[model samples]
Target: MQSLDERCLRYLAEAVGCGSVRAAADKLNVNASAVSRQIVQMEGQLATPLIERHRRGVRATPAGSLLLDYYRRQASDREDILAKLTELKGLRRGHIDVVLGEGFVGDLMSGLLQGFWARHPDLTMTLDLAATNDVVRRVVEDEAHLGLVYNPPPEPRLRTHLAMPHPIRLLVRADHPLAAHPGPVRLADLAGHRLGTMHPAYGIRQIIAAAERAEGVRLDPVLITGSIGVLKQFVASGIGVTLLPAFCAAQEISAGSLVALPLADPGLDGVEAQIVTRLGRQLSPAAGTLLQHLARGMAGEARSGTRRSSSSR
Candidate 1:
């Protein structure tokens, strides 16, 4: 818990994130009137309105953005001080907040989290699973120490540390017809077959759409979902075939339950998985340690993927 003034700042940040006073109050476990009063008092203290209220909800004014930046810096500075103190005590205590894309929340994350906790027994950690854009936003806002994203966009405020170009692969059941192919699958081969995939907002979906266009074929999908797990289930049930990054189905691929056929398209190969951090912010010792671990883990996944693919023959 923070001091009263700091708590007020937290309320402001939450309000900005939520975009509603009532929603922020619900999250903060306080009455809406109290939350409104705190904001009003903060406005008075600063001699300016930090947020502009509208019928839809509220948004930060110029002053609010500035204050939020200062607040984030203060929170970061506190962490840095604690990191130094922990270093003086032999790195016995630290904490890091990481935001990851939903695709990363499965076995890969479980293994990473388990290994990290075991490796750093005295350190605490927080993990948030969100959409790709949300993960990027959290890191850019300084709310998260690190972010893992798929096909990240150009953001001047953020810097990519590890860009792993994970070529999209065709994911299908072991008994599926595509499984007969010994090498990479081309886009035109699937023109008449049913396809299952995520919505267009996802990077994978965008990649698939572009591939379909270049192949000059249009196959209406049998299933269009927002969850990769759902797509995997549908594919398992013989509903349709789908495209996924190698890491997305690593467990099944390794177990021989699912087959990942490489996509032999030039455009599809540019889709990348990246780890990112804020441009000028040097991560604390704890965060920096985890970032390196994650990078190594991802690289290991890629290498193991090559070994698995080659041995499957």
Candidate 2:
């Protein structure tokens, strides 16, 4: 027997998703009648009515919903197989999609990917900068090949590797009053201090908030911005002090451009960086090689004290 074509499976899946034959046809750029006939034929082959019709639209029957899920999974598996085959050609080509959190796009990801590019010059990479939840969602849905996230997502279909742990610290200009503080600073010490941080949606923000709450302190941030780079600039200009990962503060701290001090008591222990992908997503040959390179880099960083945690690979 001949195998089912991808287009047919795709049509069925889309029809189920849209719940209307006409809508699926529009999405697929085909005639409504064609989608209708194909779905009817598919149902006939299965010997069941796959959908329930209504005046406004159609909805998938129990059987239709199951079939749609199966089709989608099969499509994802087929793509993985194709990606693997392409890698075996040793051509070092094909795009790798990465979803990363805001601050992650800077030093860590930049350094790791720079080395990767040097080795696989022909491979293309696309990075999507977003919040942690967004990154995990993309990876879980197989919309991205890999994800760099601060917080691990809890999903049975996903696996995570601890790439590194970033030692987070409070940063300020050299002349900031807190820069001269000697011992463990109490959270109450920051009562009137101008705090700058990311939106509460980011994991780091939650970590910061929890620390403050534990000390019975409530911060009145003078600035709340999403961009870490911009926050660094604000701190450098003496606008306000902010907490940031050490790696992100490295260059400025080394250049005498900023002073990063560890917060005492509930110190910014660090943010855990994780590499997440679908549990069984077959990586392309190039992707596999890059993953190994990243693992090595993480190991090296951990050894050098540049990163806080060892590889959880």
Candidate 1, residues 140-175, lDDT tens digits: the string is 888899998888767998899888878888988999
lDDT of each: 0.82, 0.74
True-structure RMSD for candidate 1: 3.7
Shift in Å, residue 299, candidate 1: 2.3
The prediction achieving the highest lDDT against the true structure is 1
In model 1, the clashing pairs are: none
Give the residue spans of candidate 1 off by over 4 A: 1-8, 29-31, 41-49, 105-111, 181-188, 216-219, 307-313
Predicted structure with the largest TM-score when compared to the true one:
1
Off by over 4 Å in 2: 1-72, 108-111, 265-267, 306-313
Model 2: lDDT to the true structure:
0.74
